[model samples]
Target: MTSNSPKVLVFAGSAREGSLNKQLAQLAAKRIEALGGQATFIDLKDYPCPLFDQDIEAQGMPDNVLKLRAILAEHQAVFIASPEYNGFITPLLKNTLDWLSRPYEDTPGLGLFAGKWAALVAASPGGLGGIRAMPLAQQLLANLSLTVLPQPLSLPGAGSAFDEAGALKDDATGQKLDALCQRLVDSLAKTHG
Candidate 1:
């Protein structure tokens, strides 16, 4: 990657083993790297934070949350592969965002999110490909001051979407993902370069 290449943080909302969203996130991270951008692929399972609660916050911010916030702050863009749970974002993701939105030390509310860019994608076993969750996720990110990209990808029938190597089996679907990653990288170059 070059000095001006966008540094992107890539992660999925779900932590379940063999999760399709996780596979999608991994692919996105690779695509970003292939496009000459720096990608940091993280697993939420490694940075476990408790469910957001005011009582907990009143005491002190969780170390994991603080670590996550620091990681986010270092990236110019983020690529989120979320799994749709009941037509909305997963509780884990929402809770993590809630904690990240809270102020700590000299940082203001939503300080980590402000002026950052985000690209969202989803994969599901059913038809619609977790598309139902995209708008809600976008709104949540927007509320936190993130400029979400308009072009999002939702891969349906995720159970059979990938090959043994974890790459998408369908060429068309893979192309769509490529386009989304390209848009994200190009946007970063335009804004941060």
Candidate 2:
């Protein structure tokens, strides 16, 4: 059947069963579904890649990188559930971006990221929110030719935002997340259509 909705992919950088960021991503996807938009939450656990090194890249990008770019090419926009690692992005997310950006001068395969709308959402148990990581993530997306959304969704004290089943539990947080999804859809439609 033909789909009328714009497809968006939400990547959850963390794979932990209790990942608060993942929970946030799930909620964002639900919001998109509610708004008549299609959403797919991509769990990082399913994507595998070797550690990134330019020397390693010179040999050839791993097949996983190509697969990831293919996945990105199918989506109109992206929402990322980033977790902070030492006040920056998780190494896995960083590695994924590095691999996707591997096509230089001669090689082809720069789908997914270029001209795509992206939003950064970070969650941590700490009081400061994952604020330090958001800017860096935005910069990374920018470097990849993505248009990072100016307003981001950050769940401070994420420990309190989800239930045991990983569903968003707080009403206010739910509303905020819903709004973020709407913002992403609105931004993508205006930017691409």
Candidate 3:
């Protein structure tokens, strides 16, 4: 069963003060809200989790990890803006997912991701638009049982893609971003109903 408004959580992988991925995430959240879904924007900087280490897990999950897990559980869908670091997802995003995927005493395995709906977007100053990272992110999420949208946004030359207001400057690119996000919003509404 679904509520009248499906809560969609949005977040970026980067913690940099002026990250391109953060801009993309904010734009996605606006699109989701415009489509009438409730959008919850989260900053990973505020919910830092330690690097996923087996020794650390044995010691017990950190408070921030637990907090992020609870926040994720509250959302019906998730939108991620990941940055590609050396042709891979940033350590920040990977670590957050790893910690969140761990099973709590009463939670089912893969509870954070299993059957979850996800949409992906990436931005980078480089010309490739962080496209190199999408497949890996998709694979990881798919492995965890997330039904990720097959097509993801890859904003090339992100350095100049946005205007002073943080919105995409290129009309074509902005439309593509909007369309991708709309697809996720519409799919989630359809699935929940």
**How does each model score on lDDT?**
0.93, 0.80, 0.87
Arrange candidates, best TM-score first.
1, 3, 2
Candidate 1: worst 10 consecutive residues by lDDT?
A: 1-10
State which candidate, 1 or 2, has the greater TM-score: 1
Candidate 1, residue 58: the lDDT equals 89
Off by over 4 Å in 3: 1-3
What is the C-alpha local distance difference test score of candidate 2? 0.80
Collision pairs in model 3: none
After the best TM-score superposition of candidate 2, give how far the Cα of residue 168 lies from its true spot, in angstroms: 2.6
- Candidate 2: how many backbone clashes? 0
- TM-score of each model, in listed order: 0.97, 0.88, 0.95
Encode model 3's per-residue lDDT on 1-193: one tens digit a residue. 1357777889999989988899889988988888778788989999877788889889987999889989999887889999999999999998888888888878876888766799999998888999999999999888878899988999889988888888888998888888887888788788875
- Tens digits of per-residue lDDT for model 2, 1-193: 1275677898887878768888888878888878767888888777788888888778876777767877877898888999998899999898888787766545454544677888888899998668889999999888878888787878889988787766678877777777778888877767655
What is the number of residue pairs that collide in model 3? 0
- Candidate with maximal lDDT: 1
